[model samples]
Target chain A: MAEETSPRGPERRRGDALLRAIHEAALAELAEVGLGQLSMEGIARRAATAKTVLYRRWSTPHELLVDALHQAHPVEVPTPSADDLRTDLVAALKLLTDWMGTPAAGAVLAVMTERHRYPELAEALYSRVFDPRGGTFTSTVLRHYANAGTLDPRRLTPIVTQIGEALVFKLTLDLNRLPTDEELVAIVDEALLPALGFPLG
Target chain B: MAEETSPRGPERRRGDALLRAIHEAALAELAEVGLGQLSMEGIARRAATAKTVLYRRWSTPHELLVDALHQAHPVEVPTPSADDLRTDLVAALKLLTDWMGTPAAGAVLAVMTERHRYPELAEALYSRVFDPRGGTFTSTVLRHYANAGTLDPRRLTPIVTQIGEALVFKLTLDLNRLPTDEELVAIVDEALLPALGFPLG
Candidate 1:
């Protein structure tokens, strides 16, 4: 355990610190060069480490990228405060907006946007990062409410679960900007909650 | 009027016929070369026409491409069959699916997917094509129902009008396939109708 420590200083990161730096470097490299041009040597160079160090942890840049995205994937925490489905759903989408502003999000977008050219990498992304991280933002929150008996389990169909994220994407595509807080609230009130069989006034 | 006739047995096109040929060639050319590489020379070559003929009507490839998308854009016909909201909504989304199968859809996708790279083209698409064509597949149908005093106009907010198209785009992005008829029906029954104030059994 003592050997794991960097005796010199913070200049030489070790253990979890080293791993985090490598992950961040992978994402940054992906953003700069895109998925088609991602290379282990490039990532190692960006991380200021040796290619041997990266190969010790991951076989290929694809493996390292998936791990980077998985580490950066957000997990929703459904609040138990008064069983507020609206607040929870909004907060979950807020997490998505926050994540969208990250370097990992750009990496993920590059992979998805050019998925046809990199099918294997795209497949790894879904299997390793998205699926293992509860599929989507509102999905975890919806499942939590369903478990709490606050929402009808049957109402949480695939179409219903996809509403929030879908509209967010559509709105973004149309407006060329992230949805404001009020727009997010309108999404919950107008589309998502209604599909969940909530009474609309 | 005599001069307008094609004397060489359809070899020399003119007027609306020639205009349509140019439009189709533009869409095909956009799909082949993408937005950045689209040009009058390529479109005219594909259409077997002179560049001067194209210049007479349109200023640039962007202008011609937008016009092609507009011309090829589907207009919804809301059938007045027994005031059936479910059937009409499904039919509307079906129009979207059909449009998706066309070359124009690929052209549109190329522009949208690379909107940041060519912001003016994207802007022209919305203002000239999408907005002028009722905005979305279900938007026209929603307005029809609202006008017929069948659906509450209050229910046809921007979010509500967007639900059908939003889900369609989202499903296509996730599944990488067009939504089948059964899936479209599910969208109507599970999401659209419920939001439009129809009771779910």
Candidate 2:
């Protein structure tokens, strides 16, 4: 846990504060004007920062948008010690659904759609926002299951990653509904537990 | 088959021919001028149709785009058979991946994202395209599984729907990769088959 902290707490705190301000400004602008109308000048004004400051940090509006998005959707790492895999997965899935249903979720997704035209934004999005949050939690859960002898070691990462990805995908693309409690339980019983070689049914 | 043909033939043929001209023109415009630059006037000019014709059929660029998308992506409903669940799922997942990875997929996704601004367009897309293609396939597959005694009778439509939705969700939202063969197999082993009370793994 100590290693997770920055060596210079004051510097890190300052950076985090700046990032938070930028992120909140981005969100406000997006909600008010929509993604197509979001401008760096508007965000800067909302944040009470100079356009120079924004330009100094990010080369373009796209980069600034991506950075703000990354800050708003910081990576989430699941803590996997909830007694059993099912309980841990339910908690994790619930968190994911909550995030997806948030205002930030729509903002992030809008940026993703825009990523088709700007491929670099896709890489930034994947590396900064998605990979850290979803990717880390997925790996942590699979690793815990393997260590507990609940999951087959060989298939652990791929199975867990796909399940996590699928949950997020459903909310973003099709259905557009948050995962229900029953659906979450089904995922645990039918997918997560069995992937760990547990007899679920 | 006769009934299916009756409603879908002459009307469909005429509709398709008109749609084909519009689609080809749209595609050419998209390639030449890009999505933001696309207009009904340009599409009509390229297709040799009046702008009024385009407007009569579709009210907005998004509507025309959706129609163009449906024309490009004809739904393929899988015939339910008593085949092994693993085999059936793999075939189905393959079709999904192929469609998502096609050239038109990005364009269609763009329209879906734009639909957020137009709720009516979003609803039309949901009923006309998304439901009939992905949603219908999911129900059909689940039904086959239930009848064959491969799925748990307790597992209802929503749960089965989640499983299907997740597969596409993962590809479009998170991993940006299609599910591999192993993943298709694992989904059945862990999620679908077990939820339905079928023994997998």
Candidate 3:
């Protein structure tokens, strides 16, 4: 009865709100400044919270940033209707492209660089970042076609599925920009579809 | 005769020797401590030279690293005799994989993160790192097969040629290791060959 009636309930709500704010601020900081420049005090400043509040939750900025990436993202790629493999693949990869244009891209890129030094973070990234984020989703889409004999089974491995992501990274690395609509179409029609044994419509 | 006998001859040789030493030391430093942590001062320390010496040559550490990647490397992929596309593609990609397995990979990876910030560097990378190194060779190989009507002309574009590179990065990012020869063979025989039209032997 005391738990239900307690004023502490409001405090709990406030704490949740503060954590949400912190997550947003932390990711924003990571994107703008990168990991080497990230600091707990900076995150706190951005979140409009006290440094003590941050330390109470995370021992270091790295801990906080990693936690933020693990949190559930609002992005939920609409399930492809399995109508056309080309349309389905383009839409799925395009969803991923939008995500890459935001702060999430920079944050993920910074953490990936640290992968060699932190194996634990790498595993966490596999489960929390890559799989849920896009890898598994895209693989399932490609695999569905492979299983149905619409796409060649050999062309449907996880690595093969990332042909779009590779083009995305190539744009990111080569031009330092996300794929243009023209580029996306080219990747889908000119490259990925044909590579997987499906040509243009 | 005066030009050849001038004391400036030894001075020129000495300068060349120091530049070679500096390039080696810079790449080693980049491999050991990535770009985020790299400093011209640290590179000078490792090279056993003055920071002033480095500054005289390069305006910044970024300049030095870029210059190092531009210097000629001993890698020369044997032209695949134009006999078998499979054999040629595998040999060309294999040469690239060998290059990635070296300290050069780390150096290049570090420089790439800076690409988003430096458009000029991006073009330099395209010409010096991507094109002269392997892109042109691989494209020519793929184009040969395409012209023969064996592989689709669509798969012969610069973007399509990156299929092998994408797989390489997938292996590197996901596994933190380069693909084994067997893996490369599978990639060529199982994936690339089929994607481009021709399948297993």
**Number of the top candidate by DockQ?**
1
Q: Clashing residue pairs, candidate 3? A: none
TM-score of 3: 0.79
C-alpha local distance difference test of each model: 0.83, 0.66, 0.71
TM-score of chain A of 2: 0.69
TM-score attained by model 2 = 0.73
Please give each candidate's TM-score. Answer: 0.73, 0.73, 0.79
- In candidate 2 the C-alpha lDDT for residue A6 amounts to 69
Per-residue lDDT over B71-107 for candidate 1, one digit per residue giving the tens place of the 0 to 100 score: 8876555454557878989998998888777888888
iRMS, all models: 3.4, 4.2, 2.8
* Model 1 chain B worst lDDT window (10 residues): B1-10
lDDT of 3 by residue, A1-201 (tens): 354346554433367777878988999987665565689988989987889999999998877877787773556564768568878877777777888776766777767765774557567766766665544446657877777778778666655676777667766666667777777776777667666765444
Best-performing candidate as measured by lDDT: 1
Q: Residue B106 in candidate 2 has what lDDT?
A: 61
What's the residue-level lDDT of B74 in candidate 3? Answer: 52
Error of 3 at B74 (Å): 6.1
lDDT of 1 at A82: 51
Q: Tens digit of lDDT per residue, candidate 2, span B66-141? A: 6777667675666765477667766676666666666566665655555555567578766777776545555677
